[model samples]
Target: MLIAPWFTITVLAGIMIAALLAIQRSGQSRYDSLVTELEQTRVALAQTKATCEERSEKKELEITVINASLNREIAERMQTEAHAKKLRKQFELILNSAGEGILGLDTDGNFIFVNTAAALMVGYEPTELIGRSHHELIHHSKPDGSPLHTGECLIQQAYRDGVVHSSSTDVFWTKDGASFPVEYVSTPITENGDIRGAVVVFRDLSAFEP
Candidate 1:
């Protein structure tokens, strides 16, 4: 039998060892790829959670802003109502203290409100005149003694014209059957340039009545 050379045996052993090292390196490369993929998935999940949280916070802030706006509107409405009530009380005090007769009527000529002195002048209790019509209360007449509708009444005329005037031809009859000639001034009350009502102040002219 021929003997194998030592040099050939050494070369063959070196080739086998190199092949084994290449196989080990391939296994380690596969493990490294799996680790990189897991890390990327974790980063994606964290970004998604952060985005959801940001959206939720924005919605909460919007709700807070809306609630604040509604609160301000409610406060403004309450203040307006309070101011109107105060003005009405002050007006009533002045009306009751005045020596002259005063009256207020709505747009439809219905008595919406009145004062104590006005009731005393007409010979009725203040509560009794709250809903009464002017035609029911006033005995409107001409110099020639004619029944009158308020359409032709002088106080109404001044209200329509938005003019203030004083007159002596006016007369008001008390509930006690006493008729009085009167000198009076009538003025229109307007809001936003629209006629709301009129105020009439008067005194009896019985001393000079013929």
Candidate 2:
């Protein structure tokens, strides 16, 4: 009986060892399958990363183009403003430096602009003449001390015809209601065929009072 019991115990132990080995093999097979799936997942992730990088590159290129276009537009605007400033300065200089007295009037027969020489010739402060009518200030009279209403006043002619060549007039009025002889070259100011004002340049010739 003792030998038979020992033999049964030995067979049971061998069967248990065989079952453990089979379970270990199955576990190893499952681990191999898992490793293969993980590798496939890694490859898919790499492809996704590459696609994202390409899209990022495209976005960067578009941003670069937009920045360059904005910079060019800003540069052009700055250049235009600088050019306008230079032209305004030039006009001021030319008007002030002229030898002849220059007067600029608005379309409504009001004084709008003038140079330093013009004020000196008219014997009034330059600011006083602004917003004042030219006709009320500068009507011509004859040399015989009478109010001279000659042909057409230069200022009115300039406003009407929108142009004036050289016309020599020999009479004008002063601030103190004194009559004098003068010569004038007058014209209208225009831009694009639109009249902005009248301009008249005059010089007193009464000094030759022969």
Candidate 3:
């Protein structure tokens, strides 16, 4: 019951050819799958790149807007400062032109400003009086060498009570410790319904007194 040698050879050759065909088909299938996967990956990468570019553009735009806003704020602040400086200079000139001695005080009785006439009358430079206590400089004592009480001083009361105080008998001292009679008016400076400080207008009575 042994098969013929030629038939056996033919059958074995056919099996070998079938196996080779199956392997080739499987390899081709795998190659097609890999190609599809690679195409998908490329598409995903392109989408990611587009999204990143869009976000980058938005960030750049935001930065540009912020810089523009900051620049505008700086410019406005500088302009306001310049205008304020100009106004201050004009105010100073007006005060310096007055004939009467003019003195400005802060809430704490410190000298904020003194015009040229005021400084000369007090025998001091304007720079010497600024920021100094007004009460301590020329009005600390009476002509009789007694210490003047803060509660009774008309000058102090002007700012404390937010009222106008005047006196013709009060005496003011010079830098060299000489005293002279003065007719003076002390007026409170009110702004926004609040008393901020005081302004003193005074004239030396030494020239007018007999």
Clash totals in order: 0, 1, 0
Q: lDDT tens digits, residues 69-148, model 1?
A: 44554465456546555656665665566555666654545555555756777788867777676656764565445667
Q: Per-residue CA lDDT of candidate 2, range 42-134, in tens?
A: 555555656697765655555456556555645655665465556545654666675556666667777766667667767778788889977
lDDT of 3 by residue, 10-118 (tens): 2332233233334444555655655565555555555565669776565556545655655565565566556555655666676677666777776788887687888
For all candidates in order, the CA lDDT equals 0.57, 0.59, 0.69
Highest TM-score: give the candidate number.
3
Worst 10 residues of 1 by lDDT: 1-10
- Model 1: how far is 137 from its true place, Å? 1.5
Over 4 Å off in model 2, which ranges? 1-90, 140-151, 207-210
Q: Pick out the ten consecutive residues of candidate 3 with the lowest summed lDDT.
A: 1-10
Better of 1 and 3 by TM-score: 3
Rank the candidate models, highest TM-score first.
3, 1, 2
Better of 1 and 3 by lDDT: 3
